[model samples]
Structure formats: structure tokens, C-alpha cells
Target: MNWYVVYTKPKWEKKVAERLNAIGVVAYCPLITKESQWSDRKKMVQVPLFNSYVFVQIEEKERNRIFEVVGAVRYLFWLGKPALVKDSEIEAIRSWLSVPETYEVAAEQWKKGDKIVLESGPFSSQSAVIQEVKKNHYVLILESLGCVLKVNKKEI
Candidate 1:
């Protein structure tokens, strides 16, 4: 079996993964936990690493079965075929999610005013400029959208 990417309804990655797994499909939806702060309290929440996408390992003959699951919209086709993801890439995602401390080291080198792209979370693939760097976090400006975001250091 090989891994293929599936497009899902917005904010439905977790649901699709769960449904696929319930049907005996090996599904993966990478997630990261981040602390969200409000005026009075802070709490950690699990958020999907990639929005609207899930990975499933299955034989080609099982494609129809996967598509029948609700929230699973379509395959991420490349050159007229479903794109295959290598095991190494999936393993890398697993490793990254498993270790939360490694993010500090990876994020330490970015300087102020540096151009950064969000690889995960709600802003996945969105470009932003680093406005300020604080301990384990960054103040970023999404110039295109005229919005400011405070993101975990590791997530940028």
C-alpha cells in the first residue's frame, strides 16, 4: 500500500481521518498542540498541521471506498494521477510532531523582518514578515491581509 493525499472539506481533516480509520483505512492527519491565550486564560489545543488534507495508505483498488467517506472530497491529483507520498516524508512529520522541543532550535535563527511562510496551522502556506521575536513565539504581520498574528516559534 502507498500513501495518497486526499482533499477534505474545510476544517474536516480530523473528521475524515477518523471516519477512514473507522472503516479500516490507515489514515494520518498530523496535528500540533499550541497554547492559545485569551485575556483571562490560556489553554492548549490540538490543531491540524495541514488544513483540509489527509493522508491514507491503501491499494489503488480501494480508492472508491475512501472517496465514499464523508468529508473526503477528492485526491490531490498530479499529472492526472493521485500523488503518492513517500514513507520518509510521513516519518519526518511524525518525528516533528513527536518532539516539541526541537522547534525552539529550528526557530532560533530567524531574524526580524525575515520573510517566513507558515507551513502548518490555519495559516498554512500563507506568507508573513517577522515583526518581532519573543521567547518561543513571534509577532508576525500578514501584509497581504493586513493582519497581525502571534504564532508559536516552532510553527513558523
Candidate 2:
């Protein structure tokens, strides 16, 4: 069996995962707790780490069974075929999430145009170039991911 990415309806990742599991399919929906502020107060809420995406482990012949669950739209396609998530990648996510949240990174002076490799977090081991250095955060360009990421000082 291989793990495949499933696209879900907006804000339905958790529900779809649950429904899939109820039907005997192994589903994983990674979640992270974030502090949300309302007008009155602040609260910590668990949100899906990847919006509208859930991972399901199933055999290729049984791929169509996933559609039996509501909110499960379709499988994510890459290079014209269903995207397969490697077992090592899935284990990495599990290990990353299982570890304690406390992280202590030695503060280092970083300047613009500096090339650095991330030592932790989701993009660990990936190199990024510092695009802008601000007092509270740094904007980095991840060429491999083709996205600009804003990393706060506390998170570095």
C-alpha cells in the first residue's frame, strides 16, 4: 500500500480524515495549535496543518474507495499521476509533530543576501537566502520551494 494525498473541501480536512478512518481506511490529518484572537479574548485552537489536504494510505486498486467519504474531492496529481507520499516523508511529519515544542536556537547576526540552511522546522536542511532583515523577523527566499518565507526571530 502507498500513501496518497487527498484533496478535500475547504475546512473539511479533519472531518474527511475521520470519515475515512471510520470506513477502515488509514487517514492522517496533521494539525497545529495556533493562538487566535477574538474581540473579547484569545484562545488556542487546533487547525489542520495543510488546509484542504489529508493523507490516506491505501492500495492503488482501492483508490476509488476514498470518494465514498464526503468532502473528499480527489487525489492530488503531480506530473499527470496521483501524487504518492513517501513513507519516510510521512514518518518525518509524525516525528516532527511528536517532538516537544521547546526549541532553542542560538541567536546569530544575519544580514541581507546571506545564504543559510534551515536547521529545523518544516523546511529543515533546505537552503534559503536572506531577502530582508527586519527587527522582528527576516524574509527569506527558498529557491527550491519557490516561495518567500517570513521567519520570526523567536522561531529561528
Candidate 3:
């Protein structure tokens, strides 16, 4: 059996993982606790670490069974093949999340209009243009992903 990446409907990561598990599929949906603020109050909520993605472990012949669960759109494909996640990588994530710690990130001095490539994180190796630089964060535009990212200085 191998681990496969599944793309899910927007905001369906946790639900899809639960449904897959109920159907005898080993599913993983990594989540992180974040503080959400509303006009009335603030609360801690669990949000999926990676939006719209879930991991499932199954044999090649059982791949199609994942579709039985709602919200599972399709397997993530890379290079014309289904994207596979190594078990070691999965274990690494598990171990990393288990420990709670603060990290000091050293950000390079970047100016507006400077093009840079992300070395890690979800947008690893993606080229981005620095649109705006603020005291606390940098606004980056990722052309390939067609998204604007506001990354914190501590996360850079």
C-alpha cells in the first residue's frame, strides 16, 4: 500500500478524512489550532493545515474506493502520474506537529519588486514577485498560482 494525495472540495478536508476513515480507508488531514477573532469574541479553532487536501493510504487496487466518500474530487497528479507521499514524510509531519515550539526566522533584506523563489513551505520552489514590503510582512504575488500571499516576517 502507498500513500496518495487527494484533492477535496473547499473546506472539506476534515470531513472527507472522517468519511474515508469510516469507510475503512486510512486518511490523514493535518490540522492546526488557530485563534479566530470575531466582532463579538475570539475563539480557538482547528483548521486544516493544508487547504483542500487529504492523504490516504491504500493499495493500488483500492485507489478507486476513495471516491465512495463525498468531497473527494480526485487524486493529485504530478508529471502525469498520481502524486505519492512517502510514509517517512507523513511521519515527519506527525512528529513535527506533536512538539510545540517557537521558531526564529531570519528574513533576508528584500525590497519591493524583487523577485524571489520560495525555498520551502506549501509554495516551495515557486517564484514570486515582492509587491509590497511592510514592517511585519511581505506581500508576494505568485504568478503561476495566480495568488497573492501575505507572509509574516517571522515565517519567512
Local distance difference test values of all predictions, in order:
0.85, 0.90, 0.88
Q: Cα lDDT of model 3 overall?
A: 0.88
TM-score of each: 0.63, 0.72, 0.66
The candidates, ranked best first by lDDT, are: 2, 3, 1
Evaluate model 1: give its lDDT: 0.85
Give the C-alpha miss distance for residue 117 in model 3, angstroms: 24
lDDT of 2 by residue, 9-85 (tens): 99999999999999999999999889999999999999998999999999999999999999999999999999999
Best by TM-score: 2
The runs of at least 3 residues in candidate 3 whose Cα sits more than 4 Å from the true structure, single-residue gaps closed, are 103-156
92-125 per-residue lDDT for model 3 (tens digits):
6786577544433345698899999986565656
Off by over 4 Å in 2: 36-42, 88-104, 154-156
Best by lDDT: 2
Q: Which ten residues in a row have the lowest lDDT in candidate 1?
A: 98-107
lDDT comparison, 1 vs 3, better candidate? 3
